[model samples]
Target: MQFIDTHAHLDVEEFAEDLPEVIIRAKEAGVAKIFLPAVDLPSVSTVLQVCRDYPNYTFPMIGLQPEEVKGDYQEVLKKMKKILDASFAQSSPFIAIGEVGLDFYWSREFEQEQLIVFEEMVKWAVEYQLPLMIHCRKAQNELLHILKKYKHDLVGGVFHCFTGNQNEAAEYLKFDNFVLGIGGVLTFKSSHLREDLPACVPLERIVLETDSPYMAPTPHRGKRNESAFVANVLRQLAASYQVSEEIVASITNQNVARIFGISV
Candidate 1:
């Protein structure tokens, strides 16, 4: 069955030495497409270059990740806006504004800055009519508050690496057009996703991802993640949803197409 890794930081240094082989392995493992999201200003170029090298097999999204938010965020964002505009002018336009959102997992030092930067990214999505690849952590409440403001204007997006409870899942689904990005955490022995996910999110509202260079699935947990390992996530999702692997892939592929306006 074919699948899409809706979110992965393949541009990161972890894959620097053997990226070509990584792509080949991903194809062999049935991952048809990998969406690369920029975590900071520097990564924007790296992500785009990777997509360019792989062509249609890899896609790019521009945004400054919340965890990367710092005191100089405004300057970084301003520079990124220019690059983003230039990207659209190119033949291969970025598919989403992503890997962007609020993260309070490490510390709250940049909480206010994160919120402001996230809102700016949201506006870019609304302006460009592009889907979002959101990365949210302990600040779901704050993220939801900002998102609700542009609820009507948003085209669609993914709640990337979603490990939230049933109530949070339901709240996100209220957006109707968005989808949850289910990744390796689902396979973690200690994760509640195995039980909680099935009860909260329908197969159609979930898409598979690896968050590569991180969140590797069980059996490979603690090791560096890659798109090839996304298949493990797919298998676990099928088990969680009590459906065939093909069914999970098909429905999640459809969800990817619906949100990103791309067909695998």
Candidate 2:
């Protein structure tokens, strides 16, 4: 039942006091690795620090989240570029360019800015030959439109925390090297993923994630989430696909490896 949490925020304050315990519980629950996605400039350091502490057990990604884009985004990215270059030069590069994409969930005030930032991220991913960990919401059409240009150049990546319909799923899958990131949303009683997903998304093109410190599954619905809960996501996905949990874990782990070039 080994697993990989392809997306999570273990560096956040919620896990500050007991991150070690959280990692222990995740390992106990068979989560062999966790990928940490940076949301903003500060998180870059935090995510790196956590990955440094855990070494091979956890990996770090670099990118600016769309939701966090602001007036100073250009300056922030400039500073981050220096850090990214330094890491690359040192031979300790981040696993992916991630937590980056279009998110019009809250407001469209930064719509243009998000587009600019996302294009730059796409460029970064292509230039670095690293995969992307996209976080798209309410702007899939636009995101896909932009992504179409770079489809051939992208190495591979995951559509992190995917909760879209079948049509949207199909569109994202058009990118040969991309995979949909399945998470707690699939387990919600109200979610159509149980019915909708299996038909469109192939098990081999899917990966498990908790998106933790958020989106905990059914039994832990309203509570804080962690990598350990990816087991719950794995359970629901198995039932949805009518396969054994071991099958789900194996395929998803392979998907993670293919996309991010990591192993348990």
Predicted structure with the largest lDDT when compared to the true one? 2
Write the residue-wise lDDT of candidate 1 on 1-264 in tens digits.
Answer: 899999889898889999999999999999999999999989988998998899989999999999899999999999999988876787546999988999999899999999999999999999989999998989888999999999999999999998989999999999968999999999999999999988878888999999998999998999999999999999998888888999999999999999888887
Tell me the TM-score of each prediction against the true structure. 0.98, 0.99
Q: Which ten contiguous residues of candidate 1 have the minimum total lDDT?
A: 84-93
Poorly placed runs, candidate 2 (over 4 Å): none
**What are the lDDT figures for the candidates, one per model?**
0.92, 0.93
What tens-digit string does per-residue lDDT give for candidate 2 at 141-239? Answer: 899888999999999999999898999999999998799999999999999999988998899899999999999999999999999999999999999
Backbone clashes under 3 angstroms, per model: 0, 0
Task: Give the clashing residue pairs of candidate 2, or none.
Answer: none
Question: Which runs of model 1 end up more than 4 angstroms from their true locations?
Answer: none
